[model samples]
Target chain A: MSSPSRQPLLEVRNLRVEFFGRRGRLLALDDVSFHIDPGEVLGVVGESGAGKSLTGASIIGLLEPPGRISGGEILLEGKRIDNLPYEELRRIRGRQIGAIFQDPLTSLNPLYRVGEQIVETIRTHLPMSEQQARKRGIELLQEVGIPSAAERFDHYPHQFSGGMRQRVVIALALCAEPKLIIADEPTTALDVSIQAQIITLLKRLCRDHGTAVMLVTHDMGVIAETADRVAVMYAGRIAEIGPVQDVVKRARHPYTHGLMGAIPEMGADIDKLTQIEGAMPRLNSIPPGCAFNPRCPSAFDRCREEKPYLLPVERSQVACWLYDETGARREAAHG
Target chain B: MIAFILRRLAQAVLVMLTVAFIAFAMFNFVGDPINNMVGQDTSLQDREALRQSLGLNDPLVLRFGRFVANAAQGEFGVSFRLAEPVSRLILNALPATMELAIVAALLAVIFGVMLGVYTGLYPNRWLSRFFLTISLIGVSLPTFLIGILLILVFAVLLGLLPSFGRGEVVRIGWWSTGFLTWSGIKALILPSITLGLFQMTLIMRLVRSEMLEVMRTDYIKFARARGLTNRAINFGHALKNTLVPVITITGLQLGAIIAFAIITETVFQWPGMGLLFIQSVQFADIPVMAAYLILVAVIFVVINLIVDLLYFAVDPRLRIDGGRSGH
Candidate 1:
């Protein structure tokens, strides 16, 4: 758990992202903020268009064209990193932070061998010879649970199966010993059996290296299994963020509660799980008040009128009208 | 991998034989070699004697068989008017055209790739518009027009270059190169630039589209996130991946450049295989004409082989099939 006495490894404050698209400007991310402590995994769970991947990309400085970080500060170890020059930023990227993309095939360059790709990344951040980098690359592959890592060093990405390719990608991300890694849906493309293996490897690596990870996925199962703390997002905004156990087991926001309720438990015999009312609003047509208010069953008079700010409620931070002073006092009076 | 190459080699041989038979048949369809060899005043016996010695009197199939046999031994018989071996004649004129095509292709690749990569990385409306306009002009204009326009500007109007003939030939070993002389280089510029422009535009478009596509791939985003420098990401990663398609396009374009060099050669009046081909065609020099077609077919086959090899080198997926798993 992140304490007040220790500075968090990475902090994103009031992060706002926009896209000047063909249909006019759409706010992709609105005041999204979170923090990942050292050696902690922060799972960002949301729907397909919930901006979970976008947040990871924004943090990793890989937001593609049309989408740009409009406002906010990304701080790494208390140093402002959002506005660094390209060269300086690039240095920070390979040295300080690494990225694992959703699709392993897309992450690995087909022309080069997997070992070569890992070696290139290692050499880019660290001052080492080719042989040294290669040795480290093999070590990384082995650490990532790749079978026969030494012999597989010269094998191309296409030569490896989908699961093996993802393992190679993991090795590539860890080559530089980065302080933080942004893994966006790292196991989505793998087999059901392989997914667990990959998740275990990622967890073990993070623990071994004491690396902070921003694990973005729509799979709440993966989130519960891997993340220390979790951030639930809806319509590009963080609906709730707290310890994984707290957010998953004892959800604060309406969206988070609905999300946790939807997950099917093994022994429970309930046929129809609790379902939310409506879908998360489109980025272009996000409701003015709370983004999830349309689907929230507890929406009140103030929930329709004004956007609820993220406020402290115990250890978790939630952005919903129900948790506010007026809503709480009203609930007390009603009871 | 060895099996792949062996299979391609066998296919090349089959293609060469097919092209040779087609060339032989096409040549026979043209005017008689006897008419081109002997003057109008020559007697019937003399014509018969000349046809007999040249094996022209034989049946078309027998002559084709004989021609095939001779060609197999690197002999394409003698030219009708020139009275020189067709192989020697083609060999003599090959260098200038080759030099021209090589220069043009190289320039096309360098300029095209650089410009395409630049625009691909930093796509803007104005730059794309500029590329579109250039592509329109380059794609719309035929080779001859581009050649003539270049000549009219640099040769006729400016008087800076020689319009006709391959400058002085400097024989080096078995090969005679035109680019060894200063005037040869000067003569080469207009034609190479003229020939290269169309291909350059083709290459530029290919590289641009491939680069644009590759830049959006997951690897590129991952590379950027890894904090690789722009140079490393664009040139090292993006450009390298884009080259798989570009290489194939360039290889095919190289064959096209050689084929189109005939028109380019005639327009420039350059003494190359293309010039020999036109002159041989006009005079009904069957051997030279047949040899030229066979030569071109061989060039294409060789290029195909090279491209296949390169494909294997660049892409590992191509080798995944017919292989066992694991290292």
Candidate 2:
């Protein structure tokens, strides 16, 4: 997945998102960059307000007012999409990049039949007649595991349970068979047991459809189970990005290390789970040097003054001075 | 669906019966109808004979039963003032009031929903702001004052419309319609606006707020994310959701238009039920007064029933979940 020779399906380069408020301009996401390869699941794991969802929203061109991408080049298959006009961007939205939000209860319009919504989306991007779209809608519904797809087609969103509605949403997102699907906390609102079902459904769908996905969530357990690569976001910046196994087993960034440590392991002998000491910083008052420096256990003099961008560290790209020459030499001497 | 409607109809019947009882009660407090019908010089024998013939001498419950029976047969005795059948007077005035109300309601709903959606979609646009400001005036101004102002501008200044009355109505059997004749249509313009302005503004404001609220919902965001065109997203997705509330307000407002067209009728001297009711009040015409109150109640009941049915049609959640096997 990290093979640089192949062109990525989606590339977000040095993305910066800012909010204009009464207090003046505040940077929400600064220089956040990552890529998702075709048919790959790139998990974006972060705490709330970590710009995980914001990144997805920005990519899909649905950022609410006063929050905008101030600086970034969002290239979809080598074409710039960040600067496209609304009409053009809309044409690209479901046709090339689809989105799935957190709550299935509120995601589908309650007034429309689940089938009608799917059919409408299909017809919007594809040159299909209503009947054709409807047929495809039923097939897609079946594909997403909705029981009795044809019968469920006429049912309202309220008729479906939370998990079923999410399946309908996933069916809707995949209507046009877009290159990528942005699942923003798709299972966060589902039951713990149903969450695994949805995750499995999502994983199988992506594989079958060959659709790349930007899986944004705070659940590391979900990320570990489903994602091929994972990017750990800390205060609107990518603290680490690499193969999921490497990032989870050998987290190069301290924030990623602290994050992985916090997750409780089954059958472990520890009495208390590892907990990060400080809260994530707010946008207006994020620390000057590295946004995570205040909370970093290895923070030294230089770490407090200069921000570190993504640098190659083993198999992962880490944003920490601990991976630099001095730190490496110190580690060598200690070893 | 049939059961829902049947239940609503049963409720409406209950409501209408209750209104009829209240109307019946009004006759006792409104003074004797015989006194207004007869002269002071009439002998006691003659007065007694008239009362006996009219069923006034009967027991109260029996008289009420007869009254209810007559009312069910569409016979509301005779008006004390006009000395004609109460049903005929209302029938004659019914067309005028109904025409005025329907026209006003059409104007209100059409323009109200349009302006509301426009303002909700683009709250900062200059035209939207202008509509909003105009709505504020519409909502704040009294109906009579609005009617008078409309007459002043269109009738007095421009001399383009009739200041009073239903002009040149064409008779089509029992129904006299203002829709066919040109002068009749022109005559309707000022009074309808006067009658409907408040309701129009109310509907517009409700729709605008509802549209704004619906536009911000997660479904709307998902609709946009799904690449539906702006028009489809706003009107199809957002507007459809706004309709359940809009229908409720618009329905109630329509009933208000018919019931409260009194001021507009008085200002314009339109030959409608409102004007007839006012005249009946002046003359202490108990029969006509009671009939008018009952009619208004019926209108309210029917409109409310319609509103409830519209809800069932518009919102699937309100419908009993018919078919499903949930896992």
Candidate 3:
């Protein structure tokens, strides 16, 4: 493993995911790249079909059958993990890296008690007696703010409420003290009030344990509230990557700007909330030059003809042909 | 749970009563048992006297009541065919049939569950296809045909096993070696295998389908996501969930096995209840027929009751109190 100080905890370089759909092989993740530092939360925000969840699943090595990583180097502390055998990958998964899924109900095994599930996960990677594991399981449950943890240990998953079940799921994920945790829309399945509580609990727990998190959700509000940095995905590529405040306050890429505008502001006088003008292009029908060029407001001749690479901008990165030299000159003259 | 048990017990009683009433009505409406008992050469006066002596001259309702009372106390009058107490006749043959059915059911469940789990875990693979082919053949081949084939190959051709009978019914200190003898059990193998073949196939297919369906549940995926080995995921989690339905079908099949045992007994001539039933039916022994019908009804009811109770044990969610608590 690379030293914590010198290397990012998890890094993806030139990652490309494809699926063998009925039409043909379709690219799902086009050269997606990002790095997550230790003890940081990188929130990925995009509408459905933007490949946000796929990115998270790919990183955790849990993509379902038929969808696969085509070309990529997913480095866990500078060691490539994309090509690892399933058994070896499984060892790294749930132990070195934890995952919290969207649905709390389905995430747990209904047959087992919540505490037993936690102990099973803990004992899988750690050497501990049943009694010791049980003790630790109770402690983790209490840490996640489940009341009467010892008493609740014997109750099955269905006995718990939705918010409580999500807590149990989080406890299961944290049982092995993994370095990186991938939470894919963890709060979406929850009620509005419970959603805030869980988000707060997760942020606090991750901070206390120094665990890096990849929080994936379509809710920009959640990203603004909980994420340290935000990666804005459009179609299959990262259109913008920067600190949450900067990205939310001043987005550079046109797609990112449209996404920010689409967020319903509090106390707005508008009759209806703004929506993005066009639908996400079909995976097979992705445009030639830029995947988002058709939806982008600042599409130029070059934007239609040549794809834009993610290039460094002020304190972040933006992929837009309008940021090129000629386009910049036009903007400067207008300013 | 107690309420559920009580409800099931009430249903069992109703079913048994219905079966007894049908048996009684059918037996009385068919013909006189006395006429069958007395030969054609007997005088009309002698026949009348015999009918009066056997209480066949009594009212049909009264005779039916008497028969039911006697059956409840384990008496079934005298079998016209066997010429002995129907209870003793049943007792003599019951063990052999019970032994055969028990062993066959046990073997079917064990082998069927093994094959089913294997096939379900690796579906569309060679092992699955092989088991599927064997199951198809088992289902198509009739039990008597299988029995004859086995006897031809193993007994006549190889001379390895006894072809028929419970092998001399050896006396051993108060315990008769009816089924304990090697030759007696060896004779049982072919018939039991034939009797169990279709049941085994049915059970295997049910278990395989249930297991495959359960394996696709999210909990199984969750188990896999926990990094559990394939064996642990397949057996510990998936198989346990599949067992409730498998067990239910097994209980139902067991009842069918009892009914099918009559045909199997005649084919093998194993001197079990089925053969007794056949002989009684041929002679028109009404009391014996009623007794056997009641016994079969009791067995079916008891098995179903046990299965109902087992459902609660297997899935805690099925407990009546558990359901009520949800509301």
User: Which prediction has the highest lDDT against the true structure?
Assistant: 2
Q: What would the DockQ be for model 1?
A: 0.56
Q: Is the docking of candidate 3 incorrect, acceptable, medium or high quality?
A: acceptable
**What TM-score does each of the candidates earn?**
0.93, 0.96, 0.90
Candidate 2: C-alpha RMSD to true structure equals 2.5
**All candidates' lDDT scores?**
0.85, 0.91, 0.83
The segments of candidate 1 whose C-alpha lies over 4 angstroms from its true place after superposition are: A1-5, A326-335, B29-61, B125-132, B320-327
CA RMSD of all predictions: 2.9, 2.5, 3.6
Measured against the true two-chain complex, the DockQ scores of the candidates, in the order shown, are 0.56, 0.69, 0.35
Every prediction: chain A TM-score: 0.95, 0.96, 0.94
Model 2 - which docking category?
medium
lDDT by residue for model 2 over A1-85, one digit each (tens)? 3465688999999999999998899898999999888999999999999999999999999999799999979999888999999
RMSD of 1: 2.9
Task: Give the Å error, residue B73, model 1.
Answer: 2.7
- What lDDT is obtained when candidate 2 is compared to the true structure? 0.91
Ten consecutive residues with minimal summed lDDT in candidate 1 chain A?
A1-10
Q: Is candidate 1 or candidate 3 better by lDDT?
A: 1
Please report, as a residue range, the 10-residue window in candidate 2 chain B with the lowest summed lDDT: B318-327
